[model samples]
Target: MNEPAQHMDVGAYALGVLDAAEAARFEEHLADCSRCAAELDSALGLTPLLADLKESAPDPGVLIARPRPALLDGLLARVVTVRRAQRTRRLCLAAAAGVLIVAGPLAGSSFTSQNAPSHSTVSAAKAMYEEGEKIGAVDPTTKVDASVSLQEKPWGTHVALKLANVRGPLTCDLVAVGRNGERQTVTTWAVPAAGYGLQGAGADKWSKEPLYTHGGAALNRNDIDRFEVRTLDGKLLDTIKV
Candidate 1:
C-alpha cells in the first residue's frame, strides 16, 4: 500500500475530528506507527473524564445568561481556577458560553442517547450510580432489578441507571417521571442474551452483569416523582420511586 505522507495527526485523530478519509488513512498508518498509536492510547485515556465533564455539566441556558464582564482580563486566570476546581469536583461551568460543555475535539464520545466507550461510558455510569442520590426496585412482575441515580443541576437532573436481573435481547429505557406526570427519557440501551447482573455471572462476563447508562433530563430532581424502567414497546419492568 502506498502510505500517505507521514503527517503527525495524533491530537486531531485522537479527538476523532479527522475527516473520514483522514481517519481511514491515519488508521492504516496507525497499523505500523507505534508512536502515534501509543499517543492515541494516552489521549483516549481522557475519554472517561471528558465524558464525565460533559455528561454532568449543568444547564446550557445558564451559561449564555451569565457572560463574563471582564472577558479578556480575567478569563485566562479563571481558566486555571476552573481546571483546578474541576480536577477536584464538577465545577458548574455556566457562562463563557458553556465553552467547556460543547466538545469540539471530543475524543471517544459515543454521544448515543450518549456514550464515550462501551466500557468507559458504563464505568462512568457506574461511578454516577455510586456517587449520586439513588433509588431502586426489583419488579414483581418482570422480576427485573433497577436503580436510578440522580444528580440535580440548575436546569435539570443528571441520571444514571444500574439494571440487573434482566434477560434479553430486549430494548429498555430509563424514563424520568415528573410529579405532574411528565415523562422524559434519560437514556436507553438494548440488553443481550446473557442478560445483566445475573447470578453466577463471572468477571469475564461483567459487561453482562448490569447495564449502566447515563443521561440528563430537563426536570429538576425535586420535581421527579419516580423513574420507570421500561421497554421500547411499552413493557414496564420496574418503577423506582424517588
Candidate 2:
C-alpha cells in the first residue's frame, strides 16, 4: 500500500479489524511516521470504550444496513489528511458516531443470539483434551493455552478447540493453515472481561471456565499442518501443530 493508503488504516488497526498482512505492513509504516503513530495512540484509547459500548448491543443479525469497511476506512482516512488537530478530532468523532448509528436500537440480546456454540462449555473442551486424540501447546510468553482435536470428513476436517488462560474484552479466531501456505478461518469468538480457563480468587463463574469451540475446514486431516489462535488484529496467541 502507498503511504496515504497505509495512513487510512489507523481506525481499523485500532479496532483490531485489520487482517495479518495488513497489520504487518502498517506496523512497518508506523515505526517511521510520528503523525500516524500519534493518531494511532489516540485512537487506541477509545477501543475499550467501543467494546464496552457493544456489550449490550442488539444482535448484528437483525441489521438490514451496516456500514461497509470501505466507508469507515475512508472516513478515517479523511481524518488523517486534515491539517488541523481540531478537524482531526471532529472527523474521528463523526466516524465513531457513524458506527454507533448503525448499531441501532441498541440493547438486550443474549450471547446465544450471535449463533456461536458447538459444544456445551468448558467441560466439553476438557473432555476432548483428556479423552481423545489431540494436539496442542502453550505460548511461553502470552501464557495463552490451546489444544485441537481433528476428525476427517468427506468434505474436509472437523476441528475442536479448547482454549484456556486468556482474558479479554478481545475478539479472537481459530485459524487452520495448510502445508501449501493456505489459511482458513475455522471459527471466531469474543472473550469477556472475566476471561476463560484461569484459576483465581474473587473470580466470577465465567472467569474460571475454559472455552470449547468447534469449526471446520476444507483441508483433510492429512493435508493440514497447524492451528493458530489469534486476536482479530493478527497477533498470534498460540499455535498447535498437527
Candidate 3:
C-alpha cells in the first residue's frame, strides 16, 4: 500500500473497523512504519473518549436539517470538547506511567506488563549486558548509556538503554540499520523527567528498560549491522554495532 492509503487505514484499524485480512496486512506494515504506528497509538490511546462519543453522539439519520450557524457552532463545540478531553487523558496517563516507573517493583510489574516487557524482561536485560555490544553516544552533549543484543531473537534486535544526567522531555528514536545500509525506524518514545538520575548513582538508580524493535519482516537479526538512537529531527545521538 502507498503511504497515503496506509495512513488513511490507520484510523480504521485503530477503531477496529478493518476486516481481519485488512487488519493483518496493516499490522504487518505497522511493524516497519513508525509513522503509522504513532498515529495508531494515538487513536488507540483515545479509545475511551471515542467510545464515550459514540455512545452519546446523536445519529445523523435522526437529526433534521438545522440552521447553518447552529450546526457549525455545535460541531465546533464538540471538537473543542474532544480535544480537551484527549489532552486531559494524555496527561493523566503520562503521570501514572511516570509514577509507576519511579515507585519500583511494588507497582512496576503491572505497568511494565501492560505497556511492554514481560517475564523475559530480566533475561533480556541480562543477555544485553553479557552479550550485547556497548554503544556510545555520538553527541558529546548528550548522556546516553545503551547496548544492542542481536542474539536475543531471530526476528529483531533488543536494546538496553539508560539515559542519565540528562534533561527530560526528550524523544528517543531507535533505528535499525541493515547490512545493505537501509534504515528502518523501530520505535520512538519520550524519556520521562524522572528517568534521569544523579551521575554517581548505580545502574539500578537509573531507569533501564529493554526495547525491542522488529524492523519488519524484511529486516532480520543478521541483516541488522547496527542500531542508532537519535532525536526526532534525525540528530545522531548514539550507535551500537551488532
Could you say which candidate leads in TM-score?
A: 1
lDDT of each candidate versus the true structure: 0.68, 0.73, 0.57
- Give residue 114's lDDT in candidate 3 (0 to 100): 62
How would you encode candidate 2's per-residue C-alpha lDDT over 83-105 as one tens digit per residue? 35766788999999975442211
- lDDT tens per residue, model 1, 116-214: 445444345676777898788999988998988889888899998888888888988889899999999988787766677777535334334566778
Model 3, position 7, has a per-residue lDDT of: 62
Per residue, candidate 3 scores C-alpha lDDT tens digits across 94-129 of 999887544433244335556666555433334344
Quickly count the clashes in candidate 2: 0
* Each model's backbone clash number: 4, 0, 0
Off by over 4 Å in 3: 1-143, 152-154, 158-165, 194-198, 201-218
Looking at model 3, residue 3 earns an lDDT score of: 60
Arrange candidates by lDDT, highest first: which order? 2, 1, 3
Q: Which of 1 and 2 is ahead in TM-score?
A: 1
Q: In model 3, where is the ten-residue run with the lowest total lDDT?
A: 208-217
Structural similarity to truth (TM-score) of each candidate:
0.49, 0.48, 0.40
Q: Once superposed on the true structure, which residue ranges of model 1 sit more than 4 Å away at CA? A: 1-122, 201-204
